[model samples]
Target: MDATPVAPPTRAADARLDRIPVVTRSHRIWVALLGIFFTFDLVDLNTFAYVAPALRSEWGLSITAVGAVTSVSFLGMFLGGLLGGRLADRFGRRPTILGSAVFYSTFSLLSAVSVNVEMLAVTRVLTGFGLQAMTGVLLVYVTEMFPREQRGRYQSLTLALGLLGVPIAAAVSRLLVPIGPGTWRWVFVIGAGGIVGVILSVRLLPESIRWQVAQGRAEEAEPVLAKLESEARGILGRDLPEPGPAVETAESGNIRELLRPPYLQRLTVASAVMICLILGFYGFSSWIPTLLVEDGYTQTESLNYSLVLAIGAVPGALLAWPLVDRFERKTLILGISLVVTVLLLAFGISSGAVLVMVIGFLINMLMQMLVAVLYTYLPEVFPTRLRGLGAGCANSVGRLSGAAGAFIVGGVYSGLGYTAVFLYLALVILLLGTLLALFGERTTRRRLEDVGSAPEPA
Candidate 1:
């Protein structure tokens, strides 16, 4: 086994670390653990959507009432994003991950036991809080742990694997929800999938090497690096490559740093991206089955419609692997949003069962691709010191927008009908592209230490 030096690379964690190529034993393990962790997140994410129609019938709730439940869940996510990143930075990524798992697991169980919509909404809020917290930290962990050159590809790979959970949730809901009146409750039980994920995480997940060194814990990073080198050397069948040139990195900064100059503009762009994403994502994806139900489809019919649409999620995420590293991150985000905009418009005007299915599939496919790319692009904008908090704040803001979007879409659908809601969604997506195109800075192929919202101070 190759012995790791006692100290971290002089410049920062990326200096010697980037010399290791994209794949290694450690890389695969990290990706697998993150993927599994995110898998349960996705499963829980779509659970309420799948159960909404049944919820309407059993609870005798209005469509707006159901939308309000979804809205409150976004409010919960807003709190989670606010806390997830700052907590990760202050506490540690692995501990944050574990804590989030425990929270979602407990609340999801509470969600299942809801005797009234009030109880369900409250539990769903807590569940959303934990889920978003884990999500924000995980995004930070993925970018920090992986090799710099192929960060986007690996992120896509992890998400593609995670995309499996959508179909799993869809299929499970389809199977369990309609079995009887109370079977819908069983679906929330599935959200406990995090319990298994947390177990796997404890066995395999390492604290992020970059985060460790950033926290002035090089001793902690060393053993992890040594194990990685030993595994990588076996794969390479020779000595490791020479270290790359070092790039400057800042010492740790407090959460308030995200509000200061240099980072403020980037925070604005990131927040815009998050808002646009939530507006589009919550308005459409979360409302799919409910949207169909509102349009006169039966509960069973809507669930079937969503299950078919779920087919596109995996391929959409997998498709990002090739294009993510190929194009400039900012330009690529704009391009994908353009396609998603057109697709959303097409879906709104679509008619006939087959046409609706086809258009929805295309919209979801491209949307997942957009999601994978944005995750890679967003973190590249912040300094390591504040990356998690910045991302968390941005995501929290988006979740706040998402709460408004759920209400806005439901109100629009009720007032103007389905087409108007879609038009509103398309507009939000276009705004996302426009904001990023004008203000987003470039970060393609540059080392993380070298890239920033503004040039580093001399």
Candidate 2:
């Protein structure tokens, strides 16, 4: 008889069988660091809006110019998300993250020195490119670190923690605007400080062993995995199993891969949900303070109202943490969409200031819940290799929709009136709810591969 030849184990086969030990402490620490980084990114993105009144008054900027400044960064984010994912796939997650931090930090500092709208716009665009790239890589890093069963909970928690930046930014803006001559500039300075913390912490963190293994550098991955395993044993008080092999489904990280059969359908649903969510979120959020001011509130009163709105988001985010893992993601999304739609319409039609504040709080709450659900859903629907690329693309598309929302609300607020603009927002939310109810897949209790495989025909 002829001797039988043995074949090498494929990456997918190795990943399917191997079970890495879980170290909760190290995982939590890493998640905290990433969350802090994301917080800074959010601060940088929204700080401009918080300081918009000051900037417009100082520069005599038209409403169109203010909208343009906000939209420019989002346009850069759209491009960054697409390119950044592919770069992370090629160069490794750690490098992409660090590079983005350095790039955005530098540009944020530059924004403080801008003398004209053109210069400010350019700096924001560059800052946005780096900010979005870091965000894309961080999502992949967080998702890959956890097991499929705990992915939703982990993602939701981190997202909630990251959103703490919203209130922090708004608070800082309110406090500084009264004391400083260039308070908006100071906001950018604070954002720069946050990036410095990220740069230092990220250096001490380990690269993803799964990513290393996928690149066929198993020997390099071994030491990292061994260290992680040792940490796990310390926490769990038992020896842990080895991690399974890394899987590589596709070599190309191009946009074309997202359009391939299974991914295309998932992408479409994710994009639609994202677009509608942003329309609802930005429609009210971007104009909340202005609306309050128009309703006879002082600047101080408007700022306080905005703070209240930001505070409401904290509970919404926390509520999602446990339920994200417990319920169907689609159901959560659909439920929040309906709640937000109703609250926003009620807010628009109501006449009492106290009632408006109460309704605004609820709207903020449900919007944050919708966002938590979305972050959990998008990443869970893609394989480890494609997670960053797919999620980034979906997020980028959503950012574009949000930019449109800013323009639409700003344009119509003068001509169509605030009530009309809000009704239009309500209509968008209704359509989004319907789409999610009908097309969104149930992802709770399912593995990433299973979720990815459940996509319908494109």
Candidate 3:
């Protein structure tokens, strides 16, 4: 038999993947498809808040019970983030995304059929698990998709499209929940339609080529790379640039590695940021409608107010898209967090409806900006080998904290009211923002391979 000549390793795959221009037809399609999935995910996530007042009225549930229901969902999301990240690393991002969509959509359908609060809570938790884990995976995929130079811009655009679903959900709830008895079930029923995401993900999204190269699955990565290269060459009307040096990467990702050295610091800072951000987020966003209802505003009035507030999310995400790449991620995050604190405080203290609407609009805008910037920035700090795991674990911490914060808000609101909740959130945002400002890794405009290849901290 003739001797077979060995081909040199194609370890430069990450560099090649990174070298593609950020603007291409395929990239736009990916953004649109993923943005659609994210839109549905946000709709499902915000469903609980919209349904809560209805549940309280229909089930005669206490404030604590409503909080518990929300908490259970967060608990599920926490577990999902942990498991989903590991699974994505082991299996693939495409499959994980598909699985999460189906899992959450199925549970959301079941939640609609629940006969009582207990059943609803359990179903919502299951739905939340899939929804949240999917979110973590989605962020990982998105980070790996675009070149670092435009990652923020595209991610922000995707988020803007997705956040529009919040207003959609709020509007839907405004229309549906007020219709008749037991109409709240329709909110969840609508969320169950996220099954469409599974179909789109399977048919449209490709596996992360960067992930394939990092895993040393060069054979599997070839076709994906070819398609990307072809697209890039066609757009440039010439040959592709030679890729930079291959990144040195771990053979595989594991949680233990994340606990040590460079990753450990990123994990610590990311977790703190995630926790405080979610606490502040849920404190205001998730609790606002309930707080309004509790304060004697009618359910319709509360949802109407929330709907108006939700409208600002789209514009907020849009505002962040351009600036996301213009400024350092941490600097933008810190500045936005400070603005959010001021607006949150303003919203809490002001009693005039006109003032409230203005402040609420500003707050929602800043919150969406915060969300877009963080999503763009967090996954960049981890190596492709451990990106999913690191992002998942850190995000799960936020979910866990959110689970607890839900109950705390319930108790605090029941005792001290919205002002206290808003003030506490302000303090939390300040501390966490400062921590991130001090410790965050700078990844703006750097190659993923370069950013992820640095040595451990001393």
* Index of the highest-lDDT prediction: 3
Better of 2 and 3 by TM-score: 3
lDDT (10s digit) by residue, model 2, range 1-458: 21222122333432532354353676777778877877788778767777776777788888788788878887878788877877887778888887888788889899988888999999988888888888878877876666556767777777777788778878988888656557678888767645654666765666765566556654555545545555555666655454343445434355677789678887898788778876777777777766566567776777777887887776777778878778788887777788778887888788776887798888888787877777777776776566678888887887777777778888878788768777888888888878877977777766554565455334
Per-residue CA lDDT of model 1 for 164-242, tens digit only, reads 8899889999999888898889888988788887888787888877677667765667767767766767777766776
Clash pairs, model 2 backbone: 14-245, 15-245, 18-244
Q: Report RMSD (Å) for each prediction in the order shown.
A: 2.1, 5.0, 3.7
Worst 10 residues of 1 by lDDT: 4-13
Tens-place lDDT per residue, model 3, 146-228, is 87788898989988888878998899999999997888888888787668767776777889887887777866877666676
In order, candidate lDDTs are 0.84, 0.73, 0.85
Scanning candidate 2 in windows of ten residues, the lowest lDDT window is 1-10
